[model samples]
Target: MSASERYTFREVTPADLPLLAEWQLRPHVRKWWDTAEPFTAQKLKDTRVKRWIVETTQRPFAYLQDYSVHGWEDHHFFSLPKGSRGIDQYIGEADMTGKGHGPAFIAQHLKALFEAGVPVVATDPHPDNTRAISAYKKAGFEVFGSSQATQWGLILPMKVSSSS
Candidate 1:
């Protein structure tokens, strides 16, 4: 079945911490989502970001988050219009990778954000993460400009404006 038909999202909760931590340790995930410490429910609550668990018909297999660019620490992205939301996500299950799920799920999330009055959605992936960059492009995001070095690493900023 197609990813659009198999994927859905649910709010992340304390009960999901173990699964989240496990995913965080996965080699594919760790390569891009580096952190000195393990993920915890308390850490998630303390942040302003909104997070979701991406589920397939069979089981949960990914994590996703959306936060306001302006609300985050001052960055080049703040130069964009206000209410622009930024996204970060990954398919945690190794089996789920390379199956077009990333773009499908991202496009679904973007539609919901736009419908909810967000004017734009953005994502910044490490320039070397070709898989992610390709998925973002397929999901309708366009590279807004050149790559920029950030504390997180070098990122290629991309965005999708609401049709409204």
Candidate 2:
């Protein structure tokens, strides 16, 4: 079946912390996500980020987050227009990688953010993560430049603006 037909999104809750931590330990996920340190439930709870679990018809298979750029302190994104949101996501299952799911779900989430009145959305992937950069590009994001303010160190800053 098609990716859109097989997958959906659900709000992440504290109950899902164990699953998230497990996913963070996956080699594929850790390579780009940099989960060297243990991922704790408390850390998830303390962050202002909003998260979602991407599920297939039968089970959760990915993690996604959306956060306000302006709400963060000492970052370069303040120059973006107000109401800009930023996104980070990954398909947790190794089998789920390389499918069209990444771009499809990213587009789905971007539409939701835009419809919710966010003027723009951005993503910063480590410069060498070609897979993520390609997916973001397919999801309608353009590489505007690079940034050093993020934990990822050097990142390729990408963005999409609401047409409305």
Candidate 3:
């Protein structure tokens, strides 16, 4: 945790998958995901994958989960540029969106990631996700281009500030 009173990051343990899967299967989450993508509880037990699970411990009222999905050939919303580290996350609970938690979560996580030695963090949302676009801008990510069509990608580059 940084001394600036942001969020704390914790690794997801095997015991946490039940809740994770439950959240993933929620109607709103499923709709947002738009795929019958099954996130079985057993999937969280794997340690060899490049993905990671982390939780936000800031603003006690608004909990969030960050998932760094590996794009080993799969191009999703967060497919990174050659040297970029990608970040994908969501509030994970229905009651948490539209409550101004997104910016806080992004800011805090970027701070932590920079401290941990990541020079840049990249995010690519579908061009139509207005709320996400607003939140990403609010968190200091700058749109670089709109040329991605293969997976509906909209790339943004976020440079980490030294003060963070």
lDDT of 1: 0.86
lDDT tens digits, residue span 40-66, model 1: 767678555789998878589889999
lDDT of 3 by residue, 12-128 (tens): 556655665676777756554433554445654554232334344533322233334353456443454343356556556677779777777777777766777655666666666
Winner on lDDT between 1 and 3 is 1
Misplaced by over 4 Å in model 1 are: 1-6
> What C-alpha lDDT values do all the predictions have?
0.86, 0.83, 0.56
Better of 1 and 3 by TM-score: 1
Ranking the candidates on lDDT from highest down gives: 1, 2, 3
**Given candidate 1, what's the lDDT at residue 154?**
91
> Which ten residues in a row are the worst by lDDT in model 1?
1-10
Q: How many backbone clashes does candidate 3 have?
A: 0
Best-performing candidate as measured by TM-score: 1
What TM-score would each prediction reach against the true structure?
0.91, 0.88, 0.67
